[model samples]
Target: MLRSGISIISVACLLLFAPIAPSLAAIAPPLNLAHSPITQLSVPMALFSFSGSRPNYLGIEDGKLSPCPGTPNCVSSQSDDAEHGIAPLKYNNSPEQAIAELKQIIGNMKGTEIISDRADYLYVEFTSSLMGFVDDVEFYINPEQNVVEVRSASRLGESDMGVNRKRVEAIRAELNKLEAQEAQA
Candidate 1:
């Protein structure tokens, strides 16, 4: 009971403070000491951090992304079920250009680290700003379908509050906007 209670409190604190950490730091004026508490809380953050080990089944297998493990914390373009399925990213230009633009879009996002960048495949790790939760996101340029197949999944937990799905959609929106601008140029 005590462990569970602590877990709940930790999650609550993380959720409450994560979004406002930067603001707190800035609130302290020129020195920006808002991050002082963050440093102190690092121990708690590390303790509660549920970042699981990276999955070995990450890359394309047999022409498709690995299926989501019947979990809501994941979304994939190749998923057959609607709950986990998302439309693959479409591209008008060549696959090379498409992936390049994707890298550009993702590179600018907060707390993202590109893990792999091959000619036809890309893998990235995204960390939450406050709680340090990690999510793996992958993209494969499918020339056969003229789309970029994608998979995004949390490293731990069964729910991500639709974050995985929203991220893909957000990236889709950015890609669309970038392509539109490229067309104009």
Candidate 2:
């Protein structure tokens, strides 16, 4: 009878713990490609060519950032449609200082390369860490509006899993934090 009772308790314990085990496994870090033979085989095929063939449509046009393409993969502060529209980054400092701060912020982020840095405009390209997908990102300091216009679009894909939009929002959040810190100082 004692052995049967022990078995029952053990079964109950497993039933209680079984659901939590998969969640823990889900949090485990992805395999390192450097050490794994399977990942090494797949890495080369995933590395897409990012030639600079796309024409630069980044600079200020008609005192606004370029509109997002019809695809959902792009987002712009100047876009009129709700799906492609995002709020411009407002600044409390001069446009020059704000642009400088923005450059610094983009410089600190991973997998980004600044292609052009003009007095009133900045252009950057962000590459995905795993798949090597490239996204063109641009910032135009609109002094007249007291805000910095932004545009981010994927180079090749119809859908970017909201990566471009999230990138802009993340930059906006970081810039806001930086501005608050400067104000306190």
TM-score for all models, in order of appearance: 0.78, 0.73
Candidate 1 structure quality by residue, lDDT tens digits, 21-108: 7988787666656667755543443334567898898998788888898789999999889999999999998999999999999988
- Cα lDDT tens digits, model 2, 115-170, are 98988888998887545788888898888889988999988868988999999999
Question: What is the alpha-carbon lDDT of model 2 when measured against the actual structure?
Answer: 0.81
Name the regions of candidate 1 deviating beyond 4 angstroms. 1-48
Best by TM-score: 1
